[model samples]
Target: MHTIASWRRLLAEFLGTALLVTAVVGSGIMASRLSPNDVGLQLLENSVATAFALSALILTFGPISGAHFNPVVSAADWFLGRRTGTGLPGRDLAGYAAAQTTGAIAGSVLANLMFDLAPVTFASKERSAGNLWLGEIVATAGLLLLIFALGRSGRAAVAPAAVGAYIGAAYWFTSSTSFANPAVTIGRAFTDTFAGIAPASVPGFVIAQLAGLLIGVGLLLAFYPDAGRSADDIVVAHPIDQAAHRP
Candidate 1:
């Protein structure tokens, strides 16, 4: 059994994802304000802030919840570890996803409030395009690959920095700006800001991300057949609380 309570883990996921989104949306707002005309500079600032915040959040919460702020990451962990019983259990999947999504939306609202905008303004930025979908697939696939590979190789210690670096780089390289997370996409739709996405564009991005999850699984299996052995350590290693299972 696990060494941490389920509620604690869920809370960590919620707060971590919320804070991460706050960093994303908040930084985007600040970047836009700081460099009103330079889209390039704005992106750079936003990406850098996100990357740093993600890494720090991981470090802060990794030991408690594994710091999986993304639904895809949690799903990947469950899928890859199902057979071995080392990763997230089936029962907790829905809870994790729900918590992450809700927290994400809350974070976006908080960012809007911080910036003196309406609390729940829906985004109007349309991001529909074949290339953007392709970018989501590629970005999500690469992320899963990197995360699982680290677990398999026992390099999870550097996951914070490495994952951050990968995402920072992907923000520049990917066409979709590396929105490889469904919950984050949903949250971004809550605000019409520099980091927001149109609600209409959300479904497509989510579908692409899910597809990327599948592709990532296939790649992980092919390259690291024994990845399941380290499934419990994906992103970071955390002990599961066994008290609930004990008599």
Candidate 2:
């Protein structure tokens, strides 16, 4: 594969993550408006929009950055591929995380402004509960498991649709609606709309996501001991070279 420039990959990550959060927060706000009295209907609308948008974004940006809009996904790619020298390096991981996080916040603010709301109103939806935390753990772990497993099995081509479907299903199956990405969790804290999480709830959610990351690593290793061999392919394969992978 031809090597892509580091700047291009970083730009892809930034833009991809921003658009994803935009779809999520914007759809949530629209759903609430369209179904003011029907919470179930609103959730359905939100989840469907999120699922479709996620798949499309992955397809759009996967070639440039592997479409890893989530911090945990990027971190897992680094950790799993560290020993094999095939996954993202520490520096690029940091860059990806920073870009993804900032993009998420920007996306949240954009969503708010598009809806005639404040640019950075701190969210007020408190989601600090034991069950919700557990849900995050489950959701995050399952997501990583699916992503790495597909790469390991040479089935990465379906990752975009599969990941989207998993997240959409998780919205109903998990108590916390599957805020599996740390960057996204932080961004959602910036808005008080239907898709937002309380700023106070951010720490707990982040902790749970980290815990989920560890569990996901464990599960991936257990199921596919050599999964690290495909680390560079996590989420999806791109054309990043070792030089671009470096910090």
Candidate 3:
């Protein structure tokens, strides 16, 4: 029921997400190794690497897969597309989610292997406090609001940089370190490192993120009701295509 184009998009999502997670997990390991005595310095190094890597990955793959790499973002796209008919089809949305999750897991495994660690160990870092859940909700909501707001204001072309910057800022601002993406959260659970989340904690984090997604949708509907008026200019479309069409 899917076309070749859809498959290509899914593949891009897979690769992008995998790379994103690789950057996250790999940087966390490297930071821990490099800054063994200073938690603050380790965080700084990890955040910077992740931000830069994220921007690069988004720019590289946005044309092919919309650079979603996040289940919440894909779900939001599906929800908007349902109303405007310019979004991805339900089947394709599902494919995107599956690919993102698979890629995230693969990325974690690869990162662990690259570091000579066990490939399938569960994370032991407990992060399920109420404050952390609130932070996740806040982080996810802000991310979605920023993304869809750009789509509404016709500035989505800067999403790669803007989103990466927001995440980097959130790393310091949010209490839970802003695991706003569910796929990334799951992937982090596979690694028992500085960035890892315990398996028992992932459900709470994911639920908070979904709740945040709903809040983001509500905000988008209230403020940018016409963002999806043009399907091609919506949240995850190719930036190059957006540039070519400008008058």
> Per-prediction TM-score, please?
0.97, 0.95, 0.93
Model 2, residue pairs in steric clash: 91-247
Candidate of highest lDDT = 1
Worst 10 residues of 1 by lDDT: 238-247
Cα misplacement distance, residue 79 of candidate 3 (Å):
0.8
Give candidate 2's total backbone clashes: 1
Q: What tens-digit string does per-residue lDDT give for candidate 2 at 1-247?
A: 3378778889999999999999999999999999999999999999999999999999999988899999999999988887888777787989999999999999999999999998998999889999999999999999999999999999999999999999999999999999999999999999999999999999999999999999999999899988889987877788646675688
Question: Where does candidate 1 clash, by residue pair?
Answer: 2-240, 2-241, 2-242, 3-240, 3-241, 4-240, 4-241
Q: 36-83, model 1: which lDDT tens digit per residue? A: 999999999999999999999999989888898999999999998988
lDDT of 2: 0.92
* Model with the higher lDDT, candidate 1 or 2: 1
How accurate locally, in lDDT, is each candidate?
0.94, 0.92, 0.86
Candidate 3 lDDT, tens digit per residue, 1-247? 1232667788999999999999999999999999999999999999999999989998888777778899999888778767667656777878898999999999999999999999977899999899999999999999988987877677878888999999999999999888899999999999999889999999999999999999988888888787555434444465343433568
